[model samples]
Target chain A: MTRLDMFIDRMVSQRACLDFAIAETALMGGPVFELGLGNGRTYDHLRDRVTGRPIYVFERAVASNPASTPPEDMTILGDVRETLPQAVGRFGDTASLIHADLGGHNLAKNDEFARLVSPLIAPLLAPGGLMVSSDRMYFDALEQVPLPTGAVEGRCFIYRRPTA
Target chain B: MTRLDMFIDRMVSQRACLDFAIAETALMGGPVFELGLGNGRTYDHLRDRVTGRPIYVFERAVASNPASTPPEDMTILGDVRETLPQAVGRFGDTASLIHADLGGHNLAKNDEFARLVSPLIAPLLAPGGLMVSSDRMYFDALEQVPLPTGAVEGRCFIYRRPTA
Candidate 1:
C-alpha cells in the first residue's frame, strides 16, 4: 500500500473508534472532552454525533479551522499541564467521552507526552466513560479496551474507566 | 507506508468491524454466518466472540488448518451461488450477523463476486442484522452504514438491514 493508503487507514480507524466511543457513552449524563483542537475536524465530528452533552476542548491556543472551532465557553486555553489539573478540580470524574490526538510526528516525544498526560486524563472520566487516543496512554486505573472492528491495533487506543 | 503496514491495517480493520457487528447483534435472536471460510481464521474468531448464537460456515471446500476447521454439522460445502440460495430455503432472513471476506487479491474479481453474492446474502439477514464485508457489496435492500473510525474506506464495508 502507498503512504496515502496508510494515512487513510489511520483516519478511518480513528473515526471508527471515536464513533464507537460516542455511541457507547450516549446514555451517560456527562460532557465530552477533546484534548487537542488541531484542525478541529474530530471535534466537529464529535459535536455532530454527541447529543444533549457539551463538548469541551482543551488546547494551547485556538488555531483551528473557523468552522470547526469550539465556542468560547467550551474552549479551555493553556498548557495542558496546568489546565488539565484545573479541569479535574471543576468537573471531577464526570467526562463521558474524552478524545486525544495530541501526538507529534516525533515518536519519542509523543511517548513522553503520553506518559505525562495519562494520569491527568485518567481522573476526568466518569465510571464507564471511554478515552480514545492516537497515542498509547499509560493509565493505572483505566483498563485498555479492545478497539472496535476496522481499527488498526497500534494506530489507535481505547481505555475505559471501571464502573465500580 | 510499507506493504506490511497496509496488510496489518486491513487485518485490524476487518477484526474491528466484525467485533463491532458482533456486539451490535448480540441481543438479536438469530444465528451468525461466515461466508468463504478461507483458512478458517475468522470463522474461529467468530466462534470465540459470539455467545448463544450458532455459527454456520459456507465454503466450497474444507481445506484449512486443523485448529481452525469448523465442525462438519456447521459447514455447508458447495458453490456459494448454489449453497447460499439453499440456505435461504432452510433459514429465511434470520442471520443476525453475516461476515464475508470472499475477495481475492484481484480487485476487479472481488467486486464482481461481491455483486453476485450481495443479493443472495441480503435475504439471509434478520431485520437490523449486520453484514460485514471485506469488499464493497451491492445490496438493494441493505443500507450502507458509515464505517467506524480507524477503518480505511474501500478496505472494508458494513451494511445493515432495516429493522422494519
Candidate 2:
C-alpha cells in the first residue's frame, strides 16, 4: 500500500475530522496553509483537491522530516511564525485557506497567535476563502452551556474573509 | 426510553456525523438553522444543547405531520422557499448556523436555495457560525476521485458566513 493509504487507514481508525474540513474547504476552492503540519496529514489530504495551488505548511522542523515533505512542486515548508513573511512574499496574496492542527502545546496561546496570523492570512484570502483550526477551544464551555437544538460539536472554527 | 434517546440512537446509527456537527456547532456558540426538518431528527440531536437562542427549522410540511414537528419550545418550522419572509422576520438576525439534510429534492436545488437563504442567515451568525448540508451529492464524485493521503469522504459541506 502507498503511504497515503497507510495514513488514511490510521486517520479512519482514529476518526480524524480534518479530512472532512479539508474537503469542505476544497469544495469552496483553496490554496490552503496548514499551521502545525503534524506528519503532513492534511497536506496529503488536500494535495489532490487543490492541485495547482501550493499547500504551504508551517512546522518548525519540516525540512528535516523526509516522511512529511512533499514533492518540490506541491508544497512549501517552514516555521509559520518565523517564515510567514517569506511565505507571504512568495505567494503574494494568493492563500485562500489556513489549517492549524498544532497540538495542545500552543492551545492557550491561540488568541495571541490569531492576532498575529489573522491579518497575514486575511489579506491573502480570495472572496470566500476560509481558515480552519482543529483544536476545540470551547468544547467544555459548550457542554456546560446549553445551545439551540441541531447544534453539534467538533466543528473547526472557520473564519471567512468578506466576499465583496 | 425517551423520544430523545430513540432519536439519538437513530442518529448514532445513520447520521452520526450530523449529530457530531450539531454538538460542535453548539459548543462553538451557534444559533443554528436546519433546512430539512425530517421527522425532527436534527432537532432532537440538539435538544439539550439549545439554551437561550431559538433553533429555526424549515420543513415543507411539519404542520400537517405531527411526527415531523419538533418539540414546541425548540424549533420554528415552515417552508423555506415560500415562508422565508415570515421565518426571517420571526427569527430575525438570530439564524447563525443553517443545516439541510433534505435528501435528493432539496439537494438538487442546493445552489439556488443556498443563494436565497444565505443572506438572511448571514446576518444572524455570530463571528464563527456554520452552515451545513448533507446528501448523496458527493458520493459519485468521491468514488471516482482518489483522495490524497489522510483524507476520507466525510460527505458533508459546511459553509461559514463572513464575519465582520
Candidate 3:
C-alpha cells in the first residue's frame, strides 16, 4: 500500500464506523455531537445519515467547505474546553452519538488533547449511546466497543456508555 | 504506508467486517458458511464469535492448522462447482452468514473466480442475512451493502439478501 492507499483506508474506515453508529443508534432519541468540524466532511455525512435529531458541531473557528458548514443554530462557536462542559449542563446525558476527529500530526499533542477532552465528552452520551473518535480516549465511565467491519483498529475508536 | 501497513489494514478490515456481520445476523436462524478456508484463520475467528450455529467449511483439500480445521462433519470437500450446487440442494436459502476470502494475489484470476463463484454463493444466504467477501462479487439477487468502518474500500465487500 502507498500513502494514498493508507489514506483511503482511514477515510473508508471512518465512514464505515460512522454509518454503523448512525444505524445502531437510530431508535435512541437524542442529539448528535461532532467535535472538530475541520472541512466538515464527516459532519456533512452525518447530516445525510441522521434524521429527527439535532447535530451539534463544536468548533473554535468556522473554516470549512461552504456547502458543508453547519447552520448557525447548530454550530457551537467556542473552544471545546468551555463548550463541552456547557453542553453537558444544557443537554445532560442525552447524546445518542458523538464523533471526534481531533488528532493532528503530533502524536503527543493528540494524545494530550484526547486525555483532556475524554472526560468532557463522556457525560454527554446516553446510556447505550456511542462515542466514535479517531484517537484513543481515556474515559473511566465509557467502555470501548469493538470496531465495526471496515474500520481500522487503531485508526478509529468507539466507546459506549453502558446502559446500567 | 508500506506493504506491511496495507496487509494490516486488510486483515483488520476483514475481521471488522466479519464481526459486524456476525452481530448483525445473530437473531437469524441458519448455518454459517466459510468458502475457501485457507489456513483456517477466519474459520477460527468465526468459531470464536458465532455460537449455536453450524459452521460449514468448503475446501478442495483438508490441509490446515490442526487447531483451526473444521470437523469432518462440517467440511465439504470437492471443487466449488460441484459442492456449491450440492450445498444449494441441501441447505437452500438458509445460511445466516456466508464469508468468502478466496482471492489470491492475481487480480485477473481473482476477478474471474469471483465472477464464477458469485452466483453459486448467492443462493445460500437466508433472507436479511449478510455475505462478507474479500473481493468484489457479482450477485444478481443480493444487494451490495455499505461496508462497516475499519474496512478499507475495495479491500473487502459486503452484500445482503433482501427479505421479500
Candidate 4:
C-alpha cells in the first residue's frame, strides 16, 4: 500500500465525501492540480490511483515544511496565487482539474481570493476542466454549540469551464 | 434526443449536478432509487437514459402532486422516513444508486435524516453503488445572514457503500 492509502485508512473527517470527489475526478481523466496541499493527505489518497496523468500541487508552505510533503509526487513550493501563472505557462494546455481544500479560514476569504485565483486557475483549466474548492458551512450541531466565537459555516463549490 | 435529454432541458435548479449523477449512475448500470423526489425533476432526467433499469422514487408529497411525477417512472408517494422499510423489503439487494436532494427546511435535521435514510439506502446500494445527495450549507455571501434562514445553499455528497 502507498503512504496515502495508509493515511486514508486512519483519516476520520469527511472521508466519504473526499473519496467520492477523487473517484469522480479520476473517472473524468485529466491532469489535476491540488491547492493547499494540507500535509499532503489528499495527495497521498490520489497519487497512485491517477496514472499517466500529471498531478501538480501548489503548496505555499511546503518549502518551509518539507516533512508535510510526500517524497514521490510532483508538489511545488510557492503561493498558488503567484505561482499559478508560470505553472500554467509551463504545462501549456495540459492542466484540467484544480482541487482546493484550504480549510474554513482560507475559504472565509474565498471571494477575494477567487478574484485573484480564479483568473489564473480558470485559464489553466482545459476545456471541460473543473475547479473545486472547499468551504465551511453551518451544520446544526455547530449551531447548537455555545462557542466563544460565533459559528461560520460553508461547503465546497465546483465550477466547470464549458467544453464547447 | 432521448426523453431524459428533453426533460433535463427544462429543469431550473441543480440541473448540471443532477445530469452528472444520472449519467454516472446509468454508466455504472444497476437498480437506482431517489429519496425526497421533489418535483420529480431528476426522475424525468433519467427515465429514457436508463432503459429497462428499475428506478424507484420515494416522495412524501408526490401523491398530492401528481403533476410532479413522470408517467414512465415508478414512484412511491410516501415519506422516506416512513416508507423506506417497505421499499427496501421489495428491492434491497440489487439497488446501485440513491439520489437525494432532501433539503430546504431540512438542513437542521441532516443527522437524523442521514441516519434514517442510510440504512434503507445502504442495503439497496449494490456493491460499489453510489449514494448521491445535495446538501445545503452556508457560504461567504450568507455569512452575515441570520442562522435559521438565508439563501438555500446546495452541495453534493456521495457515498460508495463498501462491498465487504
Candidate 5:
C-alpha cells in the first residue's frame, strides 16, 4: 500500500477507536481530552460521538478549520509540555476519554513529544478511563487494550487506566 | 430508479436522519427511542451514533438479527399501541430523540401504524426533543423540521417536540 493509503487507514482506525471509547465511557462519566486539535477533525467527530461531556483541547497555535475550532474556554493553548501540566492540575483524574493526535510530519520528533507528555496524561485519566492515539505507547499504570473492531492492527493504540 | 434503488435510498435517508438527530441532541439531555426494531439495522445504527443515550426499543417479537437485538429490559414486546402506552407511562417526557420506522412493505398500512402510535409517543419526548420517521406526520405539539442535509426530500420526515 502507498504511504497515503496507510495514513488514511490509520485515521480510520483512530476514529473507530474514538467511537468505541465513547460507547464504553457513556455509562462511566467524566470529561474528554483532545491532545492535538489540528484541523479538529477528530475533535469534531469526538463531540458527535460522546454527547454531554465537556472536551478540553490542547494546542500550540490556531490552525484548525474555523468550522471545527473549539471555543476559547474549551481550548488550552501554549506548548503542550507547559499547558498539559496545568490541565492535569486542573482536571486531575477527571477525563473518561483522551485522544492524543499530535506532532508534525517528522515521526521521530512525534515519538519524542508523546514520550514527554505521557507522564502528565497518566494522572489525568479517571479510573477505567480510555486513552487512544495514533502512535504506539505504553504507560506503567495504563493497561494496553485491543484495537476496536474494523481498526487496522498496529495503526492505532488503545489503553485503559484500570479501576483496580 | 428500480425498487431496489428506492429501498436503498430510503435506508440511507433513515441513517442520515439518525446521524443528524444524534448531533442535534448531543447537547440535550435524555434517553433515545427506537419505535421499530425490524432486523434491528436502524436500532444498531442508533446505538453506535448516540453512545451515551439509553435506547429503549419497541417491537412485537424477535425477528431482528440475534446479534442486534437489545437486552430484554430495553426491548418492549407485543403490539406497540399497548406496549408503547406502557412505556410512555413509565418514561413520560424523558426521551431526547425518537425514531419510528415501523410496519411492513405496504405504504398505506405503515401510515396507519404511525398514526396510531403518534399519540402514545407524544407525551414521551422531553422538551425540545427530536422525532424522525419514514412517514409524513404532524403532531399539534411537534413542528415539522427540514430533513437533515443529504436526506431524500420526501422519503423521510423530521420533527421537534418544541420546548416552547
Candidate 6:
C-alpha cells in the first residue's frame, strides 16, 4: 500500500481499536485525552463515537475548524510538555483513552517526542485505559495491544495500561 | 475443526484473550475473579500468568486438584447465586478481570445460569474492566467484544462494561 493508503488504513484501524478499548473500559467513566488539535476531525469523531464522556484537547495553538473546536475548558493550549503535566495534576490517571496524532516530517523528532511523552501518559490514564498514536511509543507501564482485524501492523499503534 | 479441536482452540483462544484483557486493565490492580474451578487448571494458569495480582476462585465445592485449590481467603464456597452476591458486596466493582468458565454437559442449564449471572458481574468489575466467559451473555451495561483473530466467535465471548 502507498503512504496515503497506509495513513487512511491507520485511521480506520484506530477507530476499530478505539471501539474495543472503550467497550473494555467504559465503566471507568474517565475523561478522554487528545494530544494535538490539528483540524479536530479526530476530536469530532471521538466525541460523536463515545457520547457523554469528557474529552480534553491539548493543542500547541488552535487551528481547528471552528465547527470542530472543543470548548474552552476542554481545550488546553501551549506547549504539550507543560500542558501535559498540568493535565496530570488535574486528571491524574483518570483518563480512559488518549490519542496522540503528532506524526510529521521529522521522523527522528517524532520518535524523540514519543519517547519523551509516553512516560507522562501513564499517570494520566486509568488502569486498563488505552493510548493510541500514529507513531510507535514505548513505556514500561504500558502494554502494546494487537490491531483490529484487517489492520496492518505499524500503521497505527495501540497500547493499554495493564489492570494489574 | 473437530469438537475436540474446537475445544482445544477455545482454550488457546481464551488464553490469548485473557492476555489482552490483562494488558488492557492491569493498572486497576484488583483481583482476577475465576467463576468456575473445573480441575483447577485454568485457575492455575491464571495464577502463573499473572503474578502479584490476587486471584479469587468461586467453586460449588472443593473438588479441584490439591495443587490448584486457592487458599481459603481467596476461595468462596456454596451456591454461586448466594456466594456471588456476597462477593459483590465485598469486592464491589474492584475486580479487573472475571473469567467465567461455567459451561457444563447441560447447555440449556448453562445458558440459564449465564443469563442469571451476567448482570451480577457489572458491579464486581471496575469501569472499563473485562468479562471473559464461555457462554454467550448480553447485558445493557456490558458491550460485547470481537473475538481474537483466530478464535471462533460462538465458542467464547468477551464483554466490557461501558465506561459511563
Retained true contacts (fraction), each candidate:
0.00, 0.00, 0.00, 0.00, 0.00, 0.00
Every prediction: chain A TM-score = 0.97, 0.61, 0.97, 0.65, 0.96, 0.92
Candidate 3, residues A82-132: lDDT per residue as tens digits? 999999999999999999998865679999999999999998999999999
Q: Which segments of model 4 are wrong by more than 4 Å?
A: A1-164, B1-14, B27-29, B63-68, B136-154
iRMSD (Å), candidate 1: 14.3
Model 1 collision count: 17
What docking grade applies to model 5?
incorrect
Instruction: State the lDDT at B43 in candidate 1.
Output: 80
DockQ of each model against the real complex? 0.02, 0.01, 0.02, 0.01, 0.01, 0.01
Q: Residue-wise lDDT of candidate 2 within B1-164, one digit each (tens)?
A: 22222223323333434444455456554466667765454555544445555666667766423533666555555556555566656556555456666654244476555556555544444555555555323221112222222222445555554445
TM-score of chain A of 1: 0.97
Clash list (residue pairs), candidate 5:
none
Tell how far residue B98 is off in model 1, in angstroms. 42
Q: What's the TM-score of every candidate structure?
A: 0.51, 0.37, 0.51, 0.37, 0.50, 0.49
lDDT of 3 at A52: 96
Q: What is the DockQ of candidate 4?
A: 0.01
Candidate 1, residue B93: lDDT: 93
User: How do the residues A43-124 of candidate 4 rate in per-residue lDDT, one tens digit apiece?
Assistant: 6555545566677778877732342354545767777867888886777555656676654333357656665566676667
Model 5, A1-164: lDDT tens per residue? 42323444676687778889888889777899998888777877877677889998898897976657899999999888888788877887889999998865577887887787888788889999999988766588999988879789978889999998
Off by over 4 Å in 2: A1-30, A48-52, A63-68, A72-77, A135-155, B1-164
The segments of candidate 1 whose C-alpha lies over 4 angstroms from its true place after superposition are: B1-164
